[model samples]
Target: MNIVLFGATGNIGKVILQEALDRGHHVTAIVRDPAKLSVQNPNLKVATGDLLRPASYEASLAGADAAIASVNDPDPDNVPKQAQVLLDTLAKAGVKRFAWVGGAGSLEVAPGVRVIDDPNFPPAWKPSAMGMVKALDVFRASKADIDWTFISPAAHIEPGERTGKYRVGGDQLLVDAQGNSHISQADYAIGLLDRLEKGDAARKRITLAY
Candidate 1:
């Protein structure tokens, strides 16, 4: 696969970049500073661009088989706007395969309740979580001629060893025997790549856990 990735230097994005390259897929990463990528492979290509100015990275989508975004906007309120920009630009660029690195807050804890709805969802995280919730809404309601997937990680994700073992679920948060929900960032990248390679969960949100 020839993949074009945004935020390829981020905490999770960099892991995705390495996973894609390790799988022998060609990747063209659009970044403001390519120096931060730090990965060198014959299949890896770098392009200069910024998400703030969609036009700067619009041309990078040419010949891309899939586009993945792992973007972060500190303001939280701007998340949906960011998602919209990606969808609109990718649509115009004729890139149909799209995936967003989503948040776990939107995952349902019950039939009609979300993790963010919990009383202990953490005040600091709600703003960003809500931003992603609205971003997911944008993806769900989007009429773009694109196949989209929103991949959410476990409720608790951080740097950890990659065991390459995990479970996949939709809508609901996955928990283990200890009632814990978490997965290593490296394994999470593997899960995302698996979905892209297998074409799983199109037009829906799938989550990862261990």
Candidate 2:
């Protein structure tokens, strides 16, 4: 498969790029600066471009089997805009399949209560969380024929050893026997790649955790 990946230098994006390459897929990593991407492989190509300006990298999206975006911004307000550009770019480029590295805040903890609505939700993270929620809304409201899949990680995600093992869920948050929701960054990458390869979760949002 040929894949075009955005945010190739981000924490999760880098891992996803590696995961794709290890699977023998040809990956074109789009980044603002090519030097920032340290990975070099026969199957990997780094393209210089900007996410907000899809025209800068529209050629890279064409003829790609799938596109995955792990790009994130500290300012939550900007994420949705980036998502909008991504969708428009992919649509214009004629790439029908896409996978977005989503935020967990939109996942429901109850019938109508989202994880971001919980009182215990960190105040500092609210903006970013809500930003992701808005991004999901943008995707849901889109009328394009793109087979878009959004994968939100566990409540807590950080760098950790990749066990290549984790559980999956939809809409609702996935918790372990101890009621804990978390997953390592490496394993989360594994889950994202699995979703891309299977294409079973298209046009839906799924969560991954322990």
| Model 1: residue 83 alpha-carbon error in angstroms | 0.9
Model 1 reaches what TM-score against the true structure? Answer: 0.95
Q: What is the lDDT of candidate 2?
A: 0.90
- Tens-digit lDDT string for candidate 2 (133-159): 999999999877688998999999999
Give the C-alpha lDDT of model 1: 0.90
Off by over 4 Å in 2: none
Worst 10 residues of 1 by lDDT: 50-59
lDDT of 1 at 111: 94
What lDDT tens digits, residue by residue, belong to model 1 across residues 49-147? 978688798777888888999988788888899898888888888886888999999998899999999998899998999999999999989988778
